[model samples]
Target: MLITDRHGRILIQRVDYRTTCLLPGGAVDADESPAQCAARELQEELGVTTTVDRGLAVDWVSADCLNAPASMRFPGEILHVYDGGTWDDEQIAAIRLPDREITSVEFVEPARLPGLMAPGDARRALSALRARINAAGPALLENGLPIAPTVLDRALRTARARHHLPFHVGPVPEQLSVVQVWGWLLAPDGRVLVLLEPDTGAALLPGGTPEPPDRGDPFITLRREVCEEAAAEFGEPLFLGHLCEPDNPYARLRYAAPLTRLGPPPVDPATGRTHIRILATPEQALELFDWGLPATDQLTAVHQARARLGIPRAARQPLTELPDATDLTTM
Candidate 1:
């Protein structure tokens, strides 16, 4: 129990047979620490406030139950008292006790404390409280231990390492291509194009031929297929190249379009250049059936590219990344 008043006056509660009043305190509970117990009781007893700075006093009372006041030595049980503060008389008078164990109370001034309380272990509490007051500003820790610098480096490092890894989307294996092709992009609006497969017959786009490793040419086969199928003498297929193989389906549908078909001629008569079929408006060409190849996605990709590469259709087998006009290179 602790006793303190607002204006530096000490509270003494009369309990047991002590001639004078003693500071109010109680036994620590079974599972509570001494500091915590002290604070709890101090608040419960004195209606006044209490705070524990380091532990103020520690004493042992043995065979307290003996009536003969036998001089038994203290073995284990220890009592911890705190040098809480003092209050003014008015504040002291306001302090009340839990009626069960306390009989009366009193306020004692430091100069006249000796005569008011029994001169036993209780007197020691007064001396301790005074020493605490003399120490000045900084208060003590609840358990008398000093707080020091602590490092959390390893913990921080562990957290960062675990949290920084990229989220795995899924598995994708790289694929090598074995063919290269080209198509005749027709339509004044660029909405229709042409392709072809050897056995399946003439596709609107003319392209298809097994490619040799690094054949050093994409139009290599485009010329052959165009002449064989359309006999249309193209000056080397201005090389708009390959579609996906339908195998390498891109994660987000590789919509990278390298499509560049010939544009309409200028109205200037002397602007001498051969007429070409780059922009084929839907109104001019018949709506041929969409590419009906086994690779539906690849056909879809080619379809999308013909229609302004609407969305990046995923890479599909039979459809491969196309080569630029300069990339005479083959798969």
Candidate 2:
């Protein structure tokens, strides 16, 4: 079973027998279906009874692929992964592991799985996680490799190389140069705009560096870049925060702006690269962004700005490409 908490951290176990951490599950018993086995294993391992639905992934492990004791006679196994659903703080608090086998349980960030678990296990877990988030039904895998891989799966293949910027929810320091300006361009429904690279599925907020035409003004750069990248217009922007990396004297500023008009999909004039525009809730936006935990604080700042700007919380929905000319004034 693949389980996650509200913050998107996956539940992994430290078993006394294995050096690599494992996702909470055990061998399937006879006369039980995969779903039944998932539920049973979850309850037995974590002492929590939750309904398991939607097989996130199915993997066929070849015989002799696994490292096992010589006497165990390991045969090929068909593995099933099911979504255990997101657990709340109270539910997490209620978890009780047995006295043996599983020595401890941890809710770890998905990015850390590679360092903690076996390589194949890490790949399978990540694929399953992407399946759940993509809402594209189940994924098929062979030895933890996706048969028909997803955009997210492909993007996450180099998880260790992802860049992270330390976010600060305050004014950009006066001594530092404001290097880039990005907008948390929020629709009336409170979903923020995210720009996706058409080919690589890389995500970014719609903004850019200050151009000569921008007169070195961050807001002007924001407006021009938003128009260039997402083909959109917005009302006054409220500065939410900035991000700075170590050994750098520059800051990347972020603002929350109410989107006024959304035009058709845009092909960035500078790069001539067509970008996909999508509106995602702050939580989903955080997932799409590769930044680490500090991204959460940035979103929290965006939420405060949203409340002050009187934007409504968007209802949960699957992420889809932004349609042309969504008039927000009438929404």
Candidate 3:
């Protein structure tokens, strides 16, 4: 089974009736472990021309397998899955699986995995795997990722190694600013509470400062920023402080967003990524604040945000800091 991220479709090959259309893997040779076997089979079938990325997990499929045996085909299989730690999708796709025994291969979105997988335990395996990945990340397995029973701090250990990119404790940027945005939330009395133009010359909140991912929390930055901004602008909160990042900035996305960004645009300095998304809502801003919302000519990023407010502060900080959400509630 060659792994790919074709939008979301995972391509699979049904090699034979015994195995069905499954992730690329096969029976281990004498003295070979399942991991060695899967890697070998994927390369053998998909062809080693493509690199296997980091290992995702081992799925246990002997119990619910629908294939007829050799009696039940495989009574159970410990599937060692690797995402193929793909770097470039284009490069991966270019690799051809010329082995002729492969009957058919095609892309199927992960969401469509349940329907494509043969029924019985495989369906359960597919469903459970999807749920676990959605919740705990794709690295955990059906039997659990840490089943090895290794000796370590039970609280600290995870199945993940240094291979994956999305989360790296030392991998995260050390210092980052928490930007507190305050926009007009219409009051029942019709008093539009907004930062004074004379104060900020813009409707954005006054607080923007760097904080550690580990220590002098970003929440502290947010609260301290709000107070300073409020004092400078004589802006009083109609409902108090609100904070937002590009996509929760600190968390995973909650919903699917449809974006048609065709661009040769600016890079986000904070993320150091080319895909720049600079947006906020009074509802989103107000989901943490309150009100209908305020229109643009209102938001700014990092250092420039502070500079525009006339609040003297530097946006730079060491990456060791972690955001303290309590700072806003503490006041």
Candidate 4:
């Protein structure tokens, strides 16, 4: 099985007998299923009990390719890789290794595994990571790669009608004069950061109409608004799509980013109060946004972002149940 932290760092273990590290897995017992063996091995090796979900990939280690002595090498082996879901820092810290077999456990970046792990093991881990990302959603390439437009991209391009100046959505008649820019800022754990309007008690993404200083770029406007509202910095931004109101000409140019840094929440100049919430799932976002069309579009963008970033989907929750806002002070 392949295990990784929330940020996609592979959890590698150094065996006492082997010079290079490998993933945390072991042979399946005579009567146990692969999943059962994976869970058991994780518990025995790391003293951590976690569910082994869907299989990620499989590796066939040929007898000729074995690095062990001829006597120790078997005819062949088929290894099953499973997805060990993301773990928090505390869970990672609690991992206790069996020193007799495992010398240590460390989280290593995927790119660095090639140098630290056996060639075959490194290939297996990298393959599993790619499979996990592909299964999660559309593959997101590194910056500057030639990426073809995805289905979401095509839809957005076709739906774009007219671009207006940025404006806020409110009860006033003049509020619809321009489009709005909304940012879907996600944390490493896959939770989204949302802003709460103190005056209206509405939960909103950290953005607003572009101010004059924004220089007319939606991305720049969103970056500035996110910093101003949540005291957060945007990572590489991915243009998800446009959320056009059916009844009105107003639309929201939505952008998604894995937040780079988060500081103390500043009072939004527009709202004059500070209260930001982190939603654990898209369903919670929908409920917090009152199940409106904009919320639905935001949910879509969130899904797209998760797929692009290779983040697993958050656990499913009741569609109508609203979770309490996690105040910025607690974040």
Best by TM-score: 2
Which of candidates 1 and 2 is the stronger one according to TM-score?
2
> Runs in model 1 with CA error above 4 Å?
1-8, 16-19, 48-53, 60-77, 88-94, 136-331
- Estimate, for each residue in 37-155, the C-alpha lDDT of model 1 and write its tens digit: 77787777765556676655554434452224344433434556676654555665666677666777765443345566554443445444433432322222222211221111001
Clashes of each: 38, 0, 25, 0
What digit string (tens of lDDT, one per residue) describes model 2 on residues 47-148?
Answer: 989787679999987767766665553566788899988877898899999988989998877778999999889988988887877677888999888898
The candidate, 1 or 4, that scores higher on lDDT is 4
lDDT winner among the candidates? 2
Candidates, ranked, TM-score: 2, 4, 3, 1
Q: Candidate 4 residues 184-300, lDDT tens each?
A: 777665666665554443456777887788776787888888877777776788876665555786666777787667666577777678753444455545433323234444466
Span of 10 residues, lowest total lDDT, candidate 3? 252-261
All candidates: CA RMSD in angstroms? Answer: 36.2, 5.4, 18.1, 17.5
* Candidate 3 per-residue lDDT over residues 32-97, each given as its tens digit: 866667677767776664444445555665554434457555556565555543225565566567
- Which residue pairs collide, candidate 2? none
Task: Order candidates by lDDT, high to low.
Answer: 2, 4, 1, 3
Candidate 3: deviation at residue 276, Å? Answer: 26
What is each predicted model's overall lDDT from 0 to 1? 0.39, 0.82, 0.36, 0.63
Model 1 vs. true fold: TM: 0.33
TM-scores for all predictions: 0.33, 0.70, 0.38, 0.45
- Quote the lDDT for 214 in model 4: 75
